[model samples]
Target: MKKFPEHFLWGAATSAPQSEGHGSLNGKSPSTWDKWYEINPEKFQKNQGPEHTSNMYENYIEDAKRMNDIHMNSFRTSIAWTRLLPDGKTINPEAVTFYRNYFHELHSNGVKPIINLFHFDMPWWLMEKGGWESRESVDAFAFYAETCFELFGDLVEYWTTFNEPMVHVECGYLYGYHYPAIHDLKKAVQVAFHTIMAHTMAVKAFKAGKYSGKIGIILNVSPCYPKSHSTEDLRAAELADLLNTKSFLDPAVLGIFPQKLIECLADNQLLPKVEVQDLHLIQMNPVDFIGMNYYQPRRVQAPATVNHPAVSPADFYEHYDWPDKKINPYRGWEIYPEALYDVAMMIKDQYNNIPWFVSENGMGVADEERFMDQTGMIQDDYRIEFMIEHLQQLHKGIEAGSNCFGYHTWTFVDCWSWLNGYNNRYGFYRLDLENDQRTLKKSGIWFKELIDRNGLL
Candidate 1:
């Protein structure tokens, strides 16, 4: 095979809450997603809703078999904290048993399991207690991490402490894009600090437990592109890069936060309140691998002049501008596939040859029309093309000497997106919302063939 290395892993990624529907009866506590929909169902595209949707909770055996048929060497999925520890204190063995059996099913087919600890799903009980903002939530997260290692570390070889920490900080705290939408940069900084400390603690706890597995932090890394040659634009891009990527990348992998980030926080007088030895703890415990969920690159430009001055984040900095870019007609996220090459090379040159994997990468389209041929499969050509371009970039990364371990596309099956609801379809296997049934898209069938051969013919 000219594509993948002999030891390289090929997998598909999914999170528990997004795929394992049946939350209503599955003993799953209300996650942030649950509460968000409850608060503003109208915000979701087309008034589409979120509930027990995918039914993976009940149909994992079929899913596993399908993955096996597709020759998936590995599978990436998250453990919903709420699904396991609904009250944030009590452990749910039923949920534990369910996952154990699912991993057992995957292993039976020789599929490597990469389990993430959190993927934007926090128990509403914890959110009620102020979620990550409160120190108690940090302790709660540590306890959950420890419990997970004790329970399922043996079957799983990969443990990702989080899936995109910056999204939680920017969306949930500063921009109010995600759940518990608040508009305070101070709170954002505090939450970001606690999350770093929590990841550090999780790594320490994982190693202390003597689990023979690789642990890492997942980041949605977007390489910033300056709009023009203007100095202001370049500085804006730098700030965006530090805030969006390095804030988590540096501390998690390099054992220290970036100096530029430290200065930026201090300049705003919004430096987070930290415990006595938080910095020491973060600098001491480093991760084993870096998980990347790349969708699109962000282009930054100088801030537009604000007409009104108020006590708000708008007073802080500026918007991003991409002077030249390719566009993804389906979603507005720029279709700059070359950035994947740039991302991989940037990591190799900057991050000390750390082992990394593409945790998630896929295109989200508005409405993928159903395709049923004589052989019974849905056709999704765009998704396959998306994978081909990105994977070629990944292959180029490997050629450039990046220690890339795997390339897992964004998802296996179409599931509920956070705010977009069911508007965007990003899956190899198409999930029919009308019937709650699963059908292998033509891309899914084609992927099976490609993986069996290790690449497209």
Candidate 2:
């Protein structure tokens, strides 16, 4: 253990839909994600659906107490669009009260609450109105953001506009992870443009509200690594980085879309439809801080074949990789701890050292129940190792002068994943979905000690 910053926020992060059960608690509406779940239940790994367990909107006070048990200094939970603005045209005060009280409870218990505006949960009403495709939706999103800042900004000091804009593009357009799934390059370009515009708009609203708080965007920056020094490989890696990470990072923080990205879109005539004033707002309004969610480094390599079955030549894959990368056996995602170092350093150098936080990072293990064995609790040692390694890398970057201010793991409790649903557990406290019982795993106890020790090696 080591002493770091006196105000370091060591905590856990979760989203409204992922942790909040969709159907129960009088919260009803077809979110883009919910519709996706209904249409393709088989898409999930074990027939697990989003209908079951999400810790909030169901067991708020108890779960808040569970988070207290883990001894976290902070907690990050997203405000669901469909929940807050159930019909997209109006605000739901009841929903707002539920969330307001939740945060008030956390604050009362000494946990700082970082509220994020969006987490890929688009209201179905908006989706039907062409979702992020129409510029009108951008206006609607901006208004909704202002409403949130007015209502909650007084108590919650940190506001995040969107979580993982790249994943939003990939899921909604390029790949079919979530709803309004489309694979058209033209549509993808439009959607990316709108998402950035929405983030920029949110920043504007936050500043306009005159709220005394840090307003920023949460980017799931999967640091890109090339396979080799070969020119093509390096080029491929850069393209991937531009598409996945830099697409939003540059514009929202740096206040300009990556030129390479703009050129790529222009070359294919897939350039998004932009209005006269949208560019101005994006360029002038930059975030006060950045919230990053890094689960793993993205290792891409040269496309095996040209003209992907899903995307055209314009949508080709960029080759990138870290040689001899370790794999998180349980989650099946590549484990490159050093990427966190590289990402932090790059953010300092690349984004001008904006204050940042590891808003979400954790390993997703399967059948964690088996780890209990004869004991009553599950001993998730692998998750402990994964987190420690990442933290070590983070410490290295911090020592080297990166302005990373905090670390919050993916979740505080074992809860529902998107399509994977309740199957993938990523919490320090494992929740029995069947009985709604909470048990502290070894990682939970370890995190408490880490909080007390101030740091861990």
Model 2 TM-score (2 dp): 0.95
Expressed as tens digits, the lDDT of each residue in 1-457 for candidate 1 is: 4577767788889888788886755677888888888889887776665576577888899889888878888999989888888887788888999999999999998789999998888788888889889888778888999999989988999999999988888899877768889887788888888898888899989988889888998999988887787998788788788888888999998999899888877777778888898889888889999999899888767777632322344543465645466667767878778889998998899999899999999988776764456666756787888888888888888888999988888778888877777788888888888877777787777777777777544
The runs of at least 3 residues in candidate 1 whose Cα sits more than 4 Å from the true structure, single-residue gaps closed, are: 306-317, 320-324, 370-376
Winner by lDDT: 1
Model 2: how far residue 236 lies from native, Å:
0.6
Question: Global lDDT for candidate 2?
Answer: 0.81
Q: Which pairs of residues clash in candidate 2, taking residues 3 or more apart in a chain or in different chains?
A: 19-54, 19-55, 300-319, 300-320, 301-319, 301-320, 302-319
By how many angstroms RMSD does model 1 differ from the true structure? 2.1
TM-score of each: 0.95, 0.95
Candidate 2 local lDDT, 54-87, one digit each (tens): 5567688887787787778799988877777776
